[model samples]
Target: MASKPGILTEWPWTRLGSFKYVVLAPWAIHSTYSYLVKDTTQRDLSNFLIFPMLLSRVLHNQIWISVSRYRTAKGNNRIVDKSIEFEQVDRETNWDDQIILSGLLFYLASMYLENGSHLPLWRTDAVIWTILLHTAVIHPFAEHIAYFALFSIPMLSTVFMKNISIISMAGYLTYIDLMNNMGHCNFEHIPKWLFSTFPPLKYLMYTPSYHSLHHTQFRTNYSLFMPFYDYVYGTMDKSSDSLYENSLTRKEEVPDVVHLTHLTTPESIYHLRIGFAHLASEPHKSKWYLWLMWPVTLWSMMVTWIYGRTFTAERNVFKHLKLQTWAIPKYNIQYYMKWQTESINRMIEGAILAASDKGVKVLSLGLLNQEEGLNSSGELFLRKHPQLKVKLVDGSSLAVAIVLNSIPKTSQVVLRGKLSKIACSIALALCQGGVKVYTMREDEHKKLKAMVSNEAGHNLILSQYGTPKIWLVGDGLSEDEQKKAPKGTLFIPFSKFPPKKDRKDCLYNSTPAMLTPKHLENVDSCENWLPRRVMSAWRIAGILHAMEEWNMHECGNMMFGIEKIWKASLENGFRPLTTSVDPKPN
Candidate 1:
């Protein structure tokens, strides 16, 4: 015998709750059509034919709410618990905002398609001419001007006048919202055989079991209308069927409420995971060494083929500290050289995937990962994985913070690098701190000199100034040039390379240089706790600082100062690590 449909899964009238909506639906449609169209007699016949479809839109929310209430009242304890958990997770993560945005996009697409047919056949030539004029003469702004003049202004006037367009738009938005809500309600009474026999039906309408997986495991099944978008984006969860079955059939009692925040315990804390294109200690630039490692590289490739691209190092967890780290291994330099364009990107994507799997909140790019040609503040990763929940951070602000704090007040310093974004930020901070800065870049030096000279009551001269007390060598400086600094000068190198042992002239090294294995060992007893392996820690700290102070969303390339870093650390419940101080002014 076929089991009867549950209250939530019954026929359309029962699911809709009130019979009053059914009775009034015909009258509502006729009234709306009569108000909008002049020829009521012709439109009334058409409206009568499509009255059911129009009525469905008006009562969608009411039906959804009725079904939801029925399910909550009749479902087992475990089912109710799962529903509550889903709601909590949705609220805490702000997933509803994303849903609304996606719905708006769908609405815009619908509007565009509808508008394309609204014009008459005779007006097609005029439309083409207008497009050509916009393309050739107006260029980029042409589209913006056309959209404003043609659609936006007219739409505004119609909305203000309370026309048919306004009524239709409201109905469309409400329909979308109700459909999205319906997709989330996990009614277990849906027949599996219906979906199994007609797979394409799943694309047009979501089954309760199908949409349940989206709430539980958020990295997949993003589309509300159909599975088509999910399939195209490669974000459809394969285990959705099994998971849904377990949710429906499980006998064990589950917790009534499960917040996503509660899941972030010490054991499952979202790691600030970091990635690198090449290790700092490795000889990445040497072609001969790279070729020599080809055999080992081939073996690694076989291993990757068998397992996967990413190889995870043991998790680094500090007992007292709330922070943890995960390092994802990438291909060696040989593979990168052989497949120059694709190699590093593949490694980066693999690392990001691994981090996302581990539930990482923030993934920081290290050293070579930030190279202009590579990830470049993780724009590529973001573009490729629009469904990715993990935040990508470049850690530029943290690097700047460390650099600024290292310099003393009123000290004269020489900057050895082309005036890059980071370098410019450092220069601005130095000037604010009453420090005189000299630069190796002649063009930038001239610009700085002129600016300083032009300032009223300032008597500082560039060429006539005495030797700088400190020399700060950035990533652009070569090893040979670093060795040429004057004797007894306080040399600070920002690049990954360590200073020579025989260099007795330099007084101190910055935090970036201290990330080396040897230097880290001297500072802490954890010889295996390689700081250089996770150099993005500095950047993570810096970005967190910026976020706290400025409420900045993207921190990939933003500049930060020491004051902001210190305050941000205090706010975020962590202490910023202090490095060795420079020598006192002679």
Candidate 2:
């Protein structure tokens, strides 16, 4: 070993730390020994001495780098810089490359050596297995030793066991390479020992056919060591499955040595089917196991059903969901019963239809749960008239009076609490610009009407039966109570209201009544068998008519109250409008 002058030269690390240099001394000594052994005439001593160490080092580098990168990539769900390099360089360090290079060097040197006739062996399999044994024993343990020398063993215990099998296999293949490849050799003719061992050795190394496949078309042809294992395990790809019928090139092929390059749906499903087959083929079949596993099977079935319906069925599920209730009109008794059961919905339907007929662009508001309304009643209305532009805003946004105050600037609808301020502000702004303001609401019709009191205000009208606070502050009122109100009060009825028992103070009048067309008509007439408040009566009638036409009973009566207030002011010679003191700025 010391006869090599280059190897015996002073170490590069002599100027560095003693402890670190001491560690590298063994490596220097080993390198010298490897150099000497390469030229040694004794094949057994050379192969036994150098091949194991070199193979182990190569495998150590490969497995450590591969697994380190795998862990790093898996942690972040992405491959970082070092991981990418590791993945690229991992398969390139096999025995064949090094062996070919070394063989060429040795062959060149042999021309000048004593009694050198020719090379012994050049087969790639012989080179690989020799390297394999080196890799198996040396790589993993060397990696652990190297890392531990630098860091601590406890820190790398996780990595120690990750690639042990690959290392062991490499060691086994390396031993086979020694016994078979270097053990028997002839330059010009087949060796007698090789013929004796060739059949059994076929199980241990790449065969002639496999070696050809690896060299020429390695992308799809990879069956290392034992081709049968590759076949049985379904790793070998014959490339029979074609993505394109006319192409024989295995159109989308992954590199033979690397498994990560290509991914296909059929390949994935094939693997899944293989897994399922394996599960089904279990030897110890038990009914109890099947019974316990039924829930998982059922869940998988449901998932598959959903997935199939989503992709394979080629239908828009959302659209289907929306139109489910409006099923193809059935001309049967069942259809008639459905129509009868949905009579109330039919009224809203009629209103929508009428709005369409009258050329009014109708849109539904206040319905937040689209699945509930749109899938049923609303969907029918929409499909019958597809041009309608309906929208669903969050109901919770308008739930409370205070929450209504903080509404984003984009909100257009006037919240219950902000109504008075918004009405006053709009009226004030528009009146200044010579634009008339017509503010409307439920019970606070009177208060909104009072906003018209501004001199510059063109025509401000609030059309509800009660005060601003009463409309929001109280629970709610009934149809009769709204109509029998005093002069300024207009009966603005709602489709439904909380019962009087629930909100007693919200009741607008002494008499009890429900919301019906007949009751609304009486409210429109404004003839409650009492002395005539002439302007109040006409204003109430006008309010009632508007509400009936627009379907805003509460809103109409509130406007009636405003009209009464305005007319009263006109009769008294146009008094300056006085608005109620609004609460603190929201």
Q: Give me the candidate number with maximum TM-score.
A: 1
Q: Which stretches of candidate 1 lie over 4 Å from their true place?
A: 1-308, 318-328, 331-339, 353-359, 383-388, 418-420, 443-466, 496-502, 513-536, 539-556, 560-562, 570-581
lDDT of 2 at 469: 30
| Predicted candidate 2, C-alpha RMSD | 30.7
lDDT of 1 by residue, 405-494 (tens): 566544577777545455666666566556767665567676555544244213222432336767666655655555665666676555
Candidate 2 displacement at residue 349 in angstroms: 3.0
Tens digit of lDDT per residue, candidate 2, span 211-315? 333334545334434444445455444531221112212122111010000101111111121122222122212233345446655564455323321110000
* All models, RMSD in angstroms: 26.1, 30.7
Clashing pairs in 1: 398-542
Candidate 2 deviant stretches above 4 angstroms: 1-343, 346-351, 354-380, 388-495, 501-586
Q: Give candidate 2's error at residue 134 in angstroms.
A: 99
Candidate 1 residue 580 Cα shift, in angstroms, is 6.1
